[model samples]
Target: MRSRGTYYLVYPLVIFLLLVLLFPFFVMISTSLKPVKEVYANPPHWIPQTIHLTNFSDIWGKYPLGSYFKNSFIVAVGTTIINMLLCIPAAYAIARLRFVGKNFMMYLFLIVQMFSPLIVVISLFKVISRLGLLDNLLALILTNGVFTLAFAIWLLSGYFRGIPKEIEEAALIDGCSRFQTITRILLPIAMPGVVTTVIYTFISAWNEFMFALTFITSMEKRPLTLGLYNFIGRWAVQWQYLMAAAFLALIPVVILFMLIERELVQGLAGGAVKG
Candidate 1:
């Protein structure tokens, strides 16, 4: 049996977590379904007079949604592919390889993240302009890829370091090449880390708003974040449509999170415990 003090301590934390996190999601769903009338009712309505399934249909049909989805998918998927391809090997190298300046290089990458995004805007814009990558999907892809690559390498490096070297040594003795050692041996063992890196890169690319807003100039090239701006007209706002758009925009990310939730948990715990 739990002690009274332990129960008292844990119960309130549980309540706090649920209220802070789950409550907003509940409100989001409620707002997504509720009509504007009930959504903004004087007292506020937790549940609507009538549930609206058509919101999803409406946004998809009404907005330039296909283009938004395409743009987001391109960036998200491209970033995921690049981060995993580079970071997995980079992580393995940092974790297992002995070389000059390895720690220094890792430190540099972490330091880059410490600065605010605003700091890099001028240089990145100049470079992007010179390369003619501004307002391009590939630009978003490359931006997200480069931005998240450092963290992926760092996180996966930690997870990789936590794994025993005996596994790779065994595979090496079995005549595996360095690449083979990574692909056939280390990767299977560190699948959790790779999965974590993939989800993190994908979600970061997907949810990225500021860079997307700035880099993407065309209406057709806009991701969901920019696409959402269309619903809020200058003079009058379409509250219902905005809510619907927000809900729809949230769906893919929610699904992605659900699929990799286990890895996310493992990744979070790994970082918290070791980092």
Candidate 2:
């Protein structure tokens, strides 16, 4: 029932998405179900004849998946909370306050965020080692917070600026403390940006490879991403086990994106429009 031109434009993208995006998920699941022998078959089995459910058990027994998962949880959750706490107040201040060198400060933050992790890996490793914190959870948690803080501040600051000054002004007249004003008035209104920050921090920490690889030498302190890579390289690549773990690795991020779909969409859309 659609016009020809409209269908022509939409169909390509639809098919492209299906082939490029959906195909990998299909492959991941299919590979996960294959037996090790079938996985190595000369002609890859499109539909795996043998369903190898024990891949999960084999991986669990072989790797320290539980420890890796716990380390990731600690880093992701800790950094998210730190990002929210540090970003909200800092964003409120930057967006709402009139101060000397405001633009200069913003520029400083932008520079920090733009700086790549690779360039500073040696410096960061030295700091971690000097702090006597190498191979510890604190190092990971703090590293995540430091790395992601600028982005959180930058994003939430924009959202705070979008909020009208009148709301906080009224709260101030009513004798509300700065803390209370931030907590009660600004936070609810800037919920989308907060959601965005949380999503970014969680995803960044959960998937971070290079920092963990450099900072965490201990097996128990390693995050899932590094663990997964190590798991793959330990022997002949167990495609079935690797795929199963990859799917598991993806679950939290997928759930997070689904849950905050609306907020994330709005936040991203609003930022695009502003830009």
Best by TM-score: 2
lDDT of 2 by residue, 16-54 (tens): 888887888899999998888999999888889989888
lDDT (Cα atoms) of all candidates against the true structure = 0.81, 0.85
Q: Write the per-residue lDDT of candidate 1 for residues 150-233, one digit (tens) a residue.
A: 878877888889889997899789888888888887888888778877888999899988788778898889987777776575
Q: What TM-score would every model get versus the actual structure?
A: 0.85, 0.89
Model 2 residue 58 lDDT score = 79
TM match of model 2 to true structure:
0.89
Most accurate candidate by lDDT:
2
Which pairs clash (backbone N, Cα, C closer than 3 Å) in model 2?
A: none
What's every prediction's RMSD, in angstroms?
3.1, 2.6
Clash totals, every prediction: 0, 0
TM-score of candidate 1 versus the correct structure, residues matched by position: 0.85
